[model samples]
Target: MHKEITIFNETILPGESKTIHMQIAKLHTMTDLQIPIIVERSKLDGPTVLFSAGLHGDEINGTEIVRQLIVQKINKPKRGTIICMPIINIFGFVNQTREFPDGRDLNRVFPGSKTGSLASRFAHYILQEIIPHVDYAIDFHAGGAQRFNAPQIRIVPNNQELKKLSDVFGAPFTLYSNHISGSFRTSCDHMGTKMLLFEGGKSLDMNQKVTDEAIEGSKRFLKHLKMLATKHQSMEAHATIYITKSDWIRANFSGMFHGLKAIGTFVKKGELLATISDPFGKIEHKVKAPHDGYLINVNDAPIVYQGDAIFHISKELE
Candidate 1:
């Protein structure tokens, strides 16, 4: 049971482990910057799982999770291989932005063309060079700046195999999201691969709880896939909810916002979600939930404009 794995366009024979840097672009002074990737291939044949993060560039928590996983020589895969791409958008990462410098989102340019934009080229390379070699994948993400998300695993409902893998990841919540066009999940699905999207924490902010959960979840996923034989304590079983639709609660008046609820809090229709007050404290307005659901995301900052998103609700089951 032997297999060959490639890292940063370089191939490694079976039972080999290596690190390679994938060149992304050059700096203003022509300094070549590359994204580091690690590949670990075992002698025995098993499922190949790819762990990718930093797709949004500012989502540092996911990037750190991949870093820690690769640095530590913990329980190695007894059968399959693990391919890790810690930073997928190096350009945006340097600028602490969610999108590439070309003003394009790398995540939204999946299965892209080689002669397209910068984001499209990177997406195309990933789809052709890496995705085809993996059996399963985990794309990590966090809420952008000013937004906070409860740790959860989002999977396509119809993909039962991926849904089962999501359960084993053991996130506090499991969200059933449909496949969106041009998303990594959509591209991978087209190639007959299963990928799970794990969302948690806030951009550029390190949350220990989210990091711990992600690390534990990744290990659990390996065990469930029969890639790791080591056993550990299991995470608490949480209610897995399916959200058919979700929408944002926007502010109707421009003012300073005072959030009354936090991420992971359940809210009812017409519930007070926040309060908007003028700078002089003379005018105040109450923001309420439009429907009953869980508060998956909420604006963390106190300042907002009249159409700024204040909260995001995903309908929950009774």
Candidate 2:
């Protein structure tokens, strides 16, 4: 039997479910905002998993994935516990921006201080109040600045456990990534919680394909932990490409950009990937693949500036 769990001064027993509204800081108008933390516990004892999204408010695709899990009753684990935080940065979500009203990226500040900024305090609360009971976590994210990423799972290289979990989750692409300083993944690593970062689509947009991929991968992940309910069947996972090295292709000249290649397609060296032309139609520049590799990310922006990263191509694969 699992012991009772406490969050926000509320106790949840085995087989019990609850939604806790956590209040941090208020808006300038003295209006209070609540971040909902939804918890579901099974009667049997097992690992505790957390599914979180919306670290960046504008990354609504992540939010949609988590919300669908609840709507689909996937959050009710067969055993152990499942905690969902569909929107982590409510402040950013309200304004439909990536950063907080104070202009701080919530993902960059981790295990924060109690006396710090609003974002920092929320960070501190999560690390202190919520993460201690979490045995595993999957944080969803989307590409920023109009860059569309293929569905992928990211983990720091060299961890066999995480690698195995990634294989079980079975995203279309698994990329080896180093932990960023003060990131939630890094903080979770410090707290001894294994975590997987799911990246797909682009900010301020929703793609059914991306969300479906995420939802299916998440079910696979839960089933691997033996937490998925019997009614929900995990789909057969496709072969995943493991990327160890990648580099971004930048725009050579500022112009109206057009992409010819699709995301997630393999490109041969010197293959024409896109073209950039001035609005005046006087000159056009061709964007070609530098080497033979898969295109993992492509900029969806109509305009590009010189040195703007427009494509992310794999340099090495495992």
List the RMSD of every prediction in angstroms.
2.0, 0.8
Please give the range of 10 consecutive residues that has the lowest summed lDDT in model 2: 1-10
lDDT of 2 by residue, 63-107 (tens): 999999999999999999999999999999999999988788999
Candidate 2 ranges beyond 4 A from true positions = none
Candidate 1 global CA lDDT score: 0.82
Lowest lDDT sum, 10 consecutive residues, model 1, at: 230-239
lDDT of 1 by residue, 76-169 (tens): 5777888899899998889999999889988899888889998998899888888888888889999887888888888876777876787788
lDDT of each: 0.82, 0.94
Error of 1 at 196 (Å): 0.1
Best by TM-score: 2
